[model samples]
Target: MDSFVYSVNATVPIFLVMILGGVIKKLNIIDDNFVNKANKYVFIVALPAMLFKDIAQSNVKKDFDISFVLFCMIVTTICFVAIWLLSELFMKDDTMKGSFIQGSFRSSAAILGLAFVQNMYSNTGMAPLMIVAAVPLYNIYSVIVLTFKAKKRNEDGSLIEVSNAENIKKACINIIKNPIIIAIFFGLWFSVLNIKFPVIIDKTITSVASTATPIALIVIGAGFEGRKAIKKIKPTIIGSVIKLILQAGIFLPIAIWMGFRNQELVSILIMLASPSTVSCYIMAKSMNNDEVLASSIIVLTTLFSSVTLTVWIFVLRMGGFI
Candidate 1:
């Protein structure tokens, strides 16, 4: 019951916010122009600010776990690479390759992961360590896959490749210039240096950061088309199964056998089983990948994670693993 409530508290509000956006759109309270501009703002400014605050506030060095971090990094990289390869071989739709790979492997580590662990243990525990290990790769690999798979519709109504050698160079430049990535580096720098922001400046940053997720979610909801989701049903199911079940199914036993327990184990579970990150949609849409598929994944995963997460928590608790 506690697990269920925790999952509800963490996930329901997100769903409600999205539903609210959808309702407003249905009422014609906001236009397509507003949604497009909001996505851009969230991607370029608000999301970066939020990530900067998250990383900068975390005490990465103090709670660092080398073995744990290495394991997470290795597994995350394997997931990313394997998913990309599978998508390339099986999914003929090049536009979906990036979104599929991202949705399959990227967990909501920064937001949902922290919330779950903190709710379960009354503290963040190893959540920060998990973020330190996984979040950077999430952003970096997203940039790579999105870049390599990006396509543009030609004047002839056929898709053209955008990832030739020159475009690869451009992708590198874009990755370097990516606002989220830059904010992450800055946050890490400040965290490592133990730099403190002035109270007013910190509050201002917080103000900007707070807009990121809500705005992104709202834009996603506003643009969401149920008919388009039916077209994406197969990939959506594959992505959700990989995200909500398979990845965790493959990794959790290994973590237990490796002797992680209690809070550490719970943190790993969140890293594996939480909903796909909101940032995946932001990055996908910005990089000209399949925003529809990305949004579908986010919606499906978020809607289902409450029940799935509760079950995982109950099992872990029953086994005395957390």
Candidate 2:
């Protein structure tokens, strides 16, 4: 019961905010153009700022658990590789391959994951460490998958697929220039060097970080397309299942068996079940993948994660794992 209420308190407000965005859009309080610009702003400025602030502020050195971090890295890599290979073998639509793979494995570690932990525990606990371990790999793997599966239109309007070697090279370049990745790097450096910011600069970062999640959620709600989601329903459902269920089902038990509990276990649960990140849609659009599919996955996962995550938390609490 406590777990259920905790889950509701953590997820319901976010769900309501998204619903508010959808309501505003339906009433024509905002239009698609505004949503489009909002997404751009989130991808370019808001998300980066939020990540920088979180990583920079985290006491990573004090809380650094090499074993936990290594486990996260291993699981994230396996998921990314396994999903991409599965998509290659099974997904018929080339256009959806990248988005499908991305939406499947990328967890919302930075935003909703942290929010869930903070709400439930009144502190971030190990969530920031979890982000440090997994989020960079998420961005790196996303770049590779999106780049390799990218297709462009020829003069005659036929699609041209990128070669593997060129895709790898381009992905390497993108990993360097990606704003989120760059921000993560700088944040890690600051944490490592124990850099302190001036009060005004810190306040500026805090203000910018504050805008990241809400604006992204609103934009996601405004741009959501139900009909398009239906068109891509198969992959969308598969990806959601992977994100909200299978990953957790597979990994959470291992975490428990390995003796992680309390805050560490709860953080692992968030890493597994907190829905697909909005960044998936952003990167899919930028990389010329199926943005509709990406957006649909985000919407569906966000809507469903409330229940799924609640169940996980309840089960974990019952079993004395958290």
TM-score winner: 1
Worst 10 residues of 1 by lDDT: 159-168
lDDT of 2 at 98: 92
**lDDT (0-100) at residue 232 of candidate 2?**
88
The superposed Cα distance between candidate 1 and the true structure at residue 192, in angstroms, equals 1.7
Candidate 2 vs. true structure, TM-score: 0.94
Overall lDDT per candidate, in order of appearance:
0.86, 0.87
TM-score of each: 0.96, 0.94
Instruction: Give one digit per residue, the lDDT tens place, for model 2 in 43-84.
Output: 889999999999898888888999999988898998899998
Off by over 4 Å in 2: 26-28
